[model samples]
Target chain A: DAGVTQSPTHLIKTRGQQVTLRCSPKSGHDTVSWYQQALGQGPQFIFQYYEEEERQRGNFPDRFSGHQFPNYSSELNVNALLLGDSALYLCASSLVAVSGNTIYFGEGSWLTVV
Target chain B: AQSVAQPEDQVNVAEGNPLTVKCTYSVSGNPYLFWYVQYPNRGLQFLLKYITGDNLVKGSYGFEAEFNKSQTSFHLKKPSALVSDSALYFCAVRESLEDFQKLVFGTGTRLLVSP
Candidate 1:
């Protein structure tokens, strides 16, 4: 079975430009979470989408936003991207149930903001 | 607040030797600990997890982790190391309850298994 998948494996955008990254959750997963991994650092939680709604958010600015479709697919959108926005954007999917969930990550979409 | 810590920046061990990657976590309630490995430019791969029952959890690639509640640590261990086992390892934890399951991850530790 195909695991979580992300689109635009690599992208380059000039500062102040906008970019949109897409993700399709695993076959049985209903929740999607986004993370940003900068060089020499751990992945930072961006936000989580459940039932097509944002349930939790991390320490990110208004420029970063996202949407989750009814099918549980997700898209992360960045407006007025800054040079510091360059990082590997990871999409993880999980099935939220009575038991605690275990998240599985995708290969990640690398964004380069110039 | 829930958090996780991986004290070592990197650990080097000779192939065929026992390998250990240290991890520690802090949480308000029972913790759901997890370990993941990442290769260069790739996503984190699920290694193993500790939720309930046994404290010594076995996982992929002949790796296992011991969950120490008293010390709030879940250190990854393998009996023998291989050059291919060298990669970045991450420690993460979340409240085991239905709610408050957002994962809090450590900075990660790079393990180098040299031949």
Candidate 2:
């Protein structure tokens, strides 16, 4: 079975531009979450999508948004990118019913804001 | 607010020796602890989690963690380390309350196992 997969593994965007990263959750998974990992820092939650609705969001700005499709795939969009937006964007997936709700992550999309 | 702390920025060990990475957490209610590993340029890989029932949680690749409720600690351990085990280890925690909460991760500890 295929695990979590992400697209545009590496990307470069200019300041004030927008970028969209895609992710396909692991097989049999339902929920999708987005995280941002800055250099030398741990990942910070951006938001989580369940049932095609954004269930929870973190302390991110309104520039960050996400969408979960009916097929359990997700897309993270960041608008008006700034220099600080350069980081590794990770996409994780999990089953809502699982006891601890263990999440599986994709390799992540690297974004460089120039 | 839930949070986790990994005190050590880096740890060095020899192959075939035992290893331990410390972690501490704070949460309002019960804490759901987790340990994950990451290679040079990869996503975080789930190693184990402590939701309930057992304090000693065993996970993939001969890894294990002991959860201490009072200490609010969940330290990752392994009996015999391998050179391939040299990677970054992260500790995360989430509140176990009825409300939904995202996992809070630490800065991560770099484990270097030498041959």
Query: Candidates' DockQ values?
Result: 0.63, 0.68
lDDT of candidate 2 at residue B94, scale 0 to 100: 79
Q: Native contacts retained per candidate?
A: 0.50, 0.64
Superposed model 1: Cα runs more than 4 Å off: B99-101
Pairs that collide in candidate 1 are none
User: In terms of lDDT, which candidate is strongest?
Assistant: 2
User: Candidate 1 chain B TM?
Assistant: 0.96
Worst 10 residues of 1 chain A by lDDT: A94-103
How many Å off is the CA of A48 in candidate 2?
0.2
Docking quality level of the chain pair in candidate 2: medium
Off by over 4 Å in 2: B97-101
Q: State the displacement of the C-alpha of residue B99, model 2, in Å, after optimal TM-score superposition.
A: 5.6
lDDT, model 1: 0.91
Interface RMS for model 1: 1.7
